[model samples]
Target: MMNEAIARNPQIQSMRYSLSSRFQAVLLGAALGEILGTQCQVMQSQQPQVKQPSQWTSLSRWGFSDSTLANRIAIAPAWGRVAVQLIKGLIRGGGGETSWINEVLDVLEIPFEQSNREPNSERNSSEQDEGSPLPDFPQIDAGLAIAALPIALFFHADPHQLEQELQQADKVWRHRPELSDGVLAISYALSLALREQLDPTQLIAEIVEELELNRDRPTTTDPSAPSNSANFVEQLRFTQSLNQTSLDRATAQIRDQLSKSQTGLDALTIAIAFHCFLNTPEDFCLSVIRAAQLHRNPQTTCLTAALSGAYNGISSIPLSWRSALSRGSSEHSPLNHLWGVATEAELQQLSDQLLAAWSGAYDLVHLLNYPGQTFAIAAPKVIRPH
Candidate 1:
């Protein structure tokens, strides 16, 4: 019955009505995007070395085979797993701290010993192509963006806390200081979405400005290693300047320019993700489909979907995708055992609880003895929906 209610209205009316919807959208959207993107990546990897050019059309209608869907269920991406951990940590009152992030990583089975052996091992890996070969090390990758989702949503109302918390949480995975810029850029985008202030036309410029402002601050990246922030900012600006009407054409033009430059994969992933979202900011499915088919990097798709999801809310996502995810949950599913979520309903509950925590109403549900309660507390003097 409660699940049915959520299905009817996932955005439980609270002091901040749509805010609850955005919370669920960010988590579930990122997770669903991760799944779809991974499936596409797997399919792409299996393709023959030589590929043929395809028509300029959206592959949003691409069908996933049963085997592919089953495979996706078996192996959730590390970023998605970490994202779940981040959500859980926030609900538990954990905040921006290396110790707190490390504890979360430890629970997720990250091998700390490997990090010790490969402090400077910077190679493209599975979870993210942006940074080190070690899974534990921070790199300018999509995983960091996804992992920062919780902090971004939890502290969406406070820019200072948002930046500070993201910076601290990112410390657990050491990498080039540019990683901070990437994480902050993603978080800032989401924060804007949650605040209902995201302007797609001005997002790139705003992020570039934000990145430039933080450059003077001390960084965790090696000072000897030249900062990639400027280059990324330039790429983003170039991407934003394209006035093409067709996504395929724009993607081609942007990809051509990026190929001629020295932009790192981390930067490339973020740039493309932004491009896809900015192109179809109003259409979550279209934006995510383009990311999945074009970028082919799970992180790119994940980030794009997350941004779109936060902006559009859960209701904006395709009902088919939402239903499929809800049905995928099973008692023995790896998603349950590993991510601690057995169904879409559980994920929604987690989002509600996080909102409740953020609203200073952590005890509301318990106080009301409503284990299945979904509404989050809203502060006084805030607008409420009729």
Candidate 2:
């Protein structure tokens, strides 16, 4: 059972409505960013050559990638089951070696065979021949951070409890230490922003400092390994330094200085940089639009949008963007095709359920209306372009 005292904590109780709105913003912003980022990439790649000026055709299809899907799983009613499994495993003296990862995979209905496959195995022979060692397990995809967002919000009132939950969840992809750190940073930032109402500059500074402190802690998978937060901290600091500049210049500077790789520290850096560069969480549309134009990694944009949205809340997002997203074409509607439901309406419901779950008010009624099974059935195994 959830800690009743914490559920009724004064801070959380007072801010319930605000937190609910932020949760909705995080999920909705992630989906919208994915859509816009995908469209931007498609547009750039398909630009036609012509002697005379002509209007470039835009891709009509728009959908979110794996990041938003993982977020859906994170906030699904089924996640309560995983929480129970974690407690049981801990009680059985399993420590951090619990089967929480398998539970999440099962709840998401992702086949073990598929999840275990090496993400880089499909790379061309030339790339493989470069002598880069294959990861012991599949590298932690950046999308996994999306799964940690709700967990962060759930434990926002208690930083210690939040860290414990994050540590347990980090075990799911222990091989990628940097990725885990990145996820933790994003979650921690969101929690503080919601609780403290910190501005972007203060939020980024606080997050970097927290991560720096975490650098000395031993990892769950490897007690001897040093914390991997250094690179992320450095990147975040750089991102903060760019706050005074225009979004375009900051983005271009980030693109030039960072590796645009959609994995490990680079991807995390990109997302954080975008969030810091915007510094104006209220302008969700401009933030996501800038992110989409930053690079080809839609996941980065999605993550940035999620973070920004968490700070700004759902009402801060532009109505135009929300309306446009909800009206996505039949084949490309992420909510309908990828999530197996109407987008805006369902997100609102999920956001409420997540708040209810954290508040210890989750009941059978909410579960029946939005069953855990819907998450597994609706989410696609893979949505990112190769």
Candidate 3:
């Protein structure tokens, strides 16, 4: 069964990485990006919605070092939770809508009926106190792009299915069309990475072409806001010109371009993610850290880290951060739990299951667990930590 599944998926066979390495990297990188990026987010807030923890008082001084504060703090972003649920939906539901939707809403503690209802703006403000859970469906931003990771991975070989699944998955947010564009761009980029077809020089161009093509679809086109594609395209084009400059200079250029284009927050965040990734395509740590520091937006940083991970594979992530992710405790720690994945081994298991589903090898877990079983997927190279 394993050999037949592998035989059917020639795309993975030709790749430079093992299926497990890329899958684990994407999940781990996104989680780490959120851990570090949200710290920056919290530090930037002068009057935070939740009380600031004392440990983070010196965040500015730590500078996102590999062995420092980022590994110790586990701040789970909404995107990580959403990505996990999406994985469940794909594997268990067989791409069915209800399974994934319920999985996602269940984690957020929101019922399917309540998903469509707008939050009561006039409700008591005290309900959002420190002890309260993060709100379901927080404002749609570039970070939400990470939630579509499963769709990209599962449907990378099928462009039509990839686009369709991405759109269906995005509808849960009830966000603006522009936000959907950002999600599509990020998802498509991941799909390209998984196929080993991603070219740093041509990534922006390809994404812009995809956005334009999607704009032609009746469901995505906004006749009233026709300039949506044009605006995003302009911002993305500017990123392509960014060379191997310092993170500060690259961030400044991104800010200047956004100011000149007068694009929305989602656009700015997506642009920042692309700029950070393009500037340091080979270094996952540097790319994600630059993203986190870019205007202190967790979503931008998380998405940037995800793209870097997909491109570089899991071996590229720093050892200290990987150790923290695998060993971190979930008790009172939001970062550790991504749909019951509190440790590195659990996340890797989930990734393997996802790969099994994608490859049509439903019994992969059984084969992998039994020492007597000899089934193994061949790879071009063995992945190892740097």
Candidate 4:
């Protein structure tokens, strides 16, 4: 009788899915959140009354922003080394004409000729002058968070190693302590979730403590010094305190404390609050939508969705939403036009390569080796300090 009962359940007979699926979900969720959040902001501006959740259907076009683009770029071969070179160029006073910029543009598949064109003919003479420093990387603010995602996933099981890698990666942020801290907190939280150590209610407090410890330690031995204000930690605590209250009150509080300004700390706080409010993986879509409603900026919503999706495997993401995204027509889907390729199959392939690299079965070099991409080399194991 017990055998017969077990045989009746097909779910029990299915093979277990791989961790790669979760990684893919994380990226997909971030993309979806960005699309939904952007659309919500448009709706809010167009109409005074809030739109019903049901009004948002799969047919709606989802367009990804720079945040998603940066995330995709971060997945390229040897991205850390590329980031290091870019930072070095910045410090050396390299202008917009720096080779690193071209390298980045190449990897992103953006047309190199586009850089030569003036942003706008209306710009002041001084702005367009040859001496004027080319504007720093346009997406540097949220790019920190996006870059940290792959790093966090790579070092998910080792917090100590994760911290070390993050410290080394701080070169990308230069003197922006708050920005660096925001990225650190987000990456650490994602790491914990990946390792299944995340407790939504206690997550904020734990991260605060971790940041405090890192801050208190002297950095003379380190290449980059820590650069954060007390307000970042305090804000995190404030957000955590609201977890005991109703979601409505928590949302209202966060909306009041954080402005529409897309500051690094503000973005991180919003993501943390949404994660806590939802308090469960099953609430991923709703949490991201609420985050979007809280702010029009796509960064906060993208970060929130990525974190939630990391915690909840891809299976938990609503099939309807995925279907809507996959079936979006070119006329209705902004993603295809903006990103060039927006199919589910392409995303899955990227996820597979990333997962392979993370698992030591492949390295960045192997993944980037065109035509001979099938050849994989063992990834070097990350050694944690004793």
Winning candidate number (lDDT): 1
Per-residue lDDT for 1-386 in model 2, tens only? 23565465545444533666786777777666655555445445554341211211122123222223322322222222333333333323323343345555555655432334465675644554664443333423555665555566666767767777677644443456666667777777777666745566466667767776666666565353334646666666666677677756866787776665344454454455346435656666556655654455556766777777876788867776677644535434544433344557666666555555555552535454654433211112212124
Give per-residue CA lDDT, model 3, range 1-386, as digits (tens): 65666577666456777667888788878777766666555444633564423343234223333323333444344668788877866766556445344555566565443334446643433543333443335544565577777777777767777887665543343435456677778878888888888898888888888888876776532233333446556666666666656556766876676577554667767877888898779888777766665557777777887889889999998886665544334543435533345666666767777776677765654734642433344333333234
Error of 3 at 195 (Å): 0.6
Please identify which of the two predictions, 2 or 3, would achieve the higher lDDT against the true structure: 3
Model 3 is weakest, by summed lDDT over 10 consecutive residues, at 52-61
lDDT computed for candidate 2: 0.55
- Full candidate order by TM-score, most accurate first: 1, 3, 2, 4
Candidate closer to the true structure by lDDT (higher is better), 1 or 3: 1
Which candidate model has the greater TM-score, 2 or 3?
3
Off by over 4 Å in 1: 1-17, 47-58, 61-77, 94-100, 107-140, 169-174, 218-228, 243-245, 254-263, 327-340, 362-371, 379-381
- What is the C-alpha local distance difference test score of each model? 0.67, 0.55, 0.65, 0.55
- Residue 127 of model 1 has an lDDT of 32
Residue-level lDDT of model 1, residues 23-134, one tens digit each, is 8888888877776676566655665462423532324434222222434444433766677777767766545434445654575565543323354445424334454444
Best by TM-score: 1
lDDT of 4: 0.55
Off by over 4 Å in 3: 1-14, 44-77, 97-138, 169-175, 220-229, 244-246, 255-263, 326-328, 337-340, 363-386
